[model samples]
Target: MPARDGDEPSFAVAADRSQWRYRPRRAFWRSRIVRAVALVTLLALCALVILALVREQTGTEGFLVGLGLAVLPVPLLMAAFRWLDRVEPGPWKNLLFAFAWGAFAAALVAILANSFAVRWIATATADPGSADDLGATVIAPVVEETAKAAAVLLLFLFRRRDFRSLVDGVVIAGFTATGFAFTENILYLGNAFGEDQDLGDGGIGAVTAGTFFVRVVMSPFAHPLFTVLTGIGFGLAALAPRGKRLRRVLLPVAGLLLSMGVHALWNGSATFGGPLAFYAVYAMFMVPAFGLLTWLAVWSRQRELRTIAGVLPAYAAAGWLSPEEPLALSSMRARRTARAVASRTYGKAGARAVGEYESFATTLAFLRERARRGTVPVPDFAAREQELLHHLWERRATASPALSYAARATGRVWVPPQYLDYGGYNPYKG
Candidate 1:
């Protein structure tokens, strides 16, 4: 029997079509083959470059020593950034790409460009020391920050959906800087180790200890903090109205300039008033800046949750969401409790359902807010809204009851399933 004209693919095909539709997509960039090749190529190049450079400067033994010492702070910095991103986690793929970019591509660009510019200046000026200082204070900061900024820029422009808020930018930037620092530390620590060896010093000598104290303990956050300014700019740009093209353009540039300025100031500190100037700047300026940024990141997460709570009431009115869900989903604790209760009662699938429910519900809130603000594209809104609604509807049977129970147990809100049977106002209901 022959199938009818429209019978082969129904409305499900509509969704499939939308999902596959061409929209200036950069799918080639996302292909596994391309990604794997690119990653291997970049990582190999960077490894070779860093390895040779470190070996040349530090010798094999010093390189090994540096590798050991430099790795101590890497995990802590990575963990801190991951912790800051807990509220609305971006895809790990994005993070991995950012890390790879910083480790290999950005570092490569910074080193090569800085070296060339320094040599050029030294040849022209006939003063190698002054050229080296100028390179550190001006050339290196601009080149390195711009190189690092490429990762954020790519995410901002190509991975727009992944970069919805300020925290996303901060995390991506932090991770990128962390990667760059990891490579840079290997060099610095290796060099310090070689210096100590040459000075006939044994054990953890004065030079090695001093370098570790300065780079690892006192200023591990230096790179991340400088680049965070650039991320902040891109983040603000992401949040701004797209129609305000001027704002969109200016914000990120401003941020990059600020990053460069601060970086130059940090580099020039040694020449300004010696090591005391570095400590003064670090204490009076950098520490406070770091604190303020941390506060801002945490505060932004809370604001995001509040935004979810505020916009979800309409879905409740339309029966897409329960009356209690807005509150339950908003509180991170309640969300966790819901997952736990679901898993306890119905096992892993139940837990997964509840998790997806929470995620879809959050997406719904953000979408509605974007639509209300007239920023959401008209062509995409209806389709995205329908897709999210369908997902929530599918998970509602298992997840809703569990989430509601969790909400009640957590003392956030409650409406027993039995209570609605009465249908009346129930003014006396507890």
Candidate 2:
């Protein structure tokens, strides 16, 4: 018999009822573990090889100095990215993988490929200086940006659920670039320290201090800035309707090209126009671009909060959530106060439940928005929606009261009888 217009797909209906249980596919049992292990091993191998190569080039004392100084900015950078992702944090595992890939796999590839290309150019033209110049201005940017973009591409493909938003793209790309910069800094600083040692000027006036000031102080965000353009491209693609294959493909490619172009320009600044030109470009172009992207990321985060406030009221009306959850969840201040209240009331367990509740609800909001926009196919929508709702329901015992209290405490009073249309989203309807 043909299904009616409003009928739920039978499989999706079944998925909702199977909420308390999870059954992984047989392939997950067989292939996924093996694949994960293989990837880890490969990353580890790359890390070891790169460590040996860098150490050999920099020598022990220089490597030690570089390692110590190079680590200073990593924690701060990671924290900034993590803060931007507070609305819908990707799994830590994904961020870890991305960072590792950048530090090891991407760095290794860039070094080896750049070295090979520069050598070839030098041999072909019999001009090591020209080859070095070309490598910095052209080959390095293309190789490095593509290498960093590989990790972003991997996450966008395999971790589609977490990679849906523009902020998500920015965060992931930022971490990857951060890791790459960390490794690259180690090399450059290590080499500078070696030069300082050779010149018997290992103090304030040394080359190491100048290198540190340039790489660490002045332009720490350089790699991240270049790569995030590619991420924005992927993120925009993610928001596109699934049927628009050409848009998805083209957006990311366009982003990659843009990233490569900017990277090349930045690299060529020193070669083409000298120190004054470099500073001019940095002040005129790089700073403005950074400010613009930073604003975009923050604006997108607020928009996400508004979306949650707007969309989740339908769920509240249907009794999946309390009347005040939408309002409370939308405000970060309320969200924090709610967690504090939870902690005071029932200790860490209560706080944990509220935190999980917050995460699940945010994810649910994004999932619904995507579904409504046709970015998520209908067949998959039912299952995912059910899963998120199930998690939310499980934590409601603790989360609901905290959220309600937060609503009141933070002046987020809920006025009811709105958002009731369901917008084709009522899963409980048979």
The lDDT leader among the candidates is 2
TM-score of model number 1: 0.88
- Candidate number of the best TM-score: 2
| Clashes within 3 Å, all models in order | 0, 0
- The C-alpha stretches of model 2 lying farther than 4 A from their native spots are 1-23, 28-31, 202-205, 414-430
Q: What is candidate 2's TM-score against the reference?
A: 0.91
Candidate 2 lDDT for residue 118: 99
What's the lDDT for all of these models? 0.83, 0.89
Cα displacement (angstroms), candidate 2, residue 421, comes to 38
| lDDT string, candidate 2, 1-430, tens digits | 1122233323433354434223345465466778889889999999999888899999988888899989999999999989999988899989999899999999999999999999999999999999999999999999999999999999999888779988888999999999999999999999999998888884524689989998999999899999999989998998999899999999999999999999999989978889999999899999999999999989989999999999999898877788899999999999999999999999999999999999999988998999999998786787677777767767887998899989988889943444454775655555
**Position 44, candidate 1: lDDT:** 81
